[model samples]
Target: MNNNPRQLAFIILQEIHRKQAFADFALDKYLRKNDLIDANRRLVTELVYGCVRRERSLDAIIDELAKKKSHQQNPDLRIILHIGLYQLSYLEQIPESAAVDTTVELAKQNKF
Candidate 1:
């Protein structure tokens, strides 16, 4: 697949936050529509849920670092950062730079 892992992860996350979509439904839809392999799809699912579950903590960090209200800040950047920070905080196998770069790229893509 041309799509990278983090990009796929970002998509799942975006669907969660923007659509308020459920994890199973969102993941199933993405898997049916996309060409991602099972492994990457699993990563997407995991990252999406993991980020969502930790949202309160993420919001705290965003509030502390960016000084913006959670509802007022750009959703795109927030999701991007959520996914990135999730990886950075929990995904030991994922390199730190990849998390930062992927989130920044997602932010740029959304013009945030």
Candidate 2:
């Protein structure tokens, strides 16, 4: 499995969506299994929890911005969007370009 923080966040969110897994449990499981650096581990935790906490607001923005509603979009794509938007909107330290580029790259990597 990919150890990149964003990639790991994607997998955790996918598990939450598909299996209704608890965020903390899934995150802890992955964090324990992977030898992520402190910063990377923090990023993964922030991305997963932030997305979950802000899901409603994110979906609202997504529905307004996308041609398709959030629920109508592919689940993985929606999660990717959430990751990007969370970083862009909440993580002031992250450059907007990096957020957009990484999120787009994730979508491409997933063959979306």
lDDT of 1 by residue, 33-86 (tens): 778777886777778778888998887877777767766777777777788778
The per-residue C-alpha lDDT of model 2 at residue 92 equals 95
Q: For candidate 2, report its TM-score.
A: 0.97
lDDT of 2 by residue, 19-52 (tens): 9999999999999999998999999999999999
Question: In model 2, which residue pairs have backbone atoms overlapping below 3 Å?
Answer: none
Q: Which portions of model 2 show Cα errors greater than 4 Å?
A: none
On a 0 to 1 TM-score scale, where does candidate 1 land against the true structure?
A: 0.83
Per-residue error for 72 in candidate 1, Å, reads: 2.2
Q: Per-prediction RMSD in angstroms?
A: 2.1, 0.8
On lDDT, the leading prediction is 2
- Least accurate stretch of 10 residues (summed lDDT) in model 1? 1-10
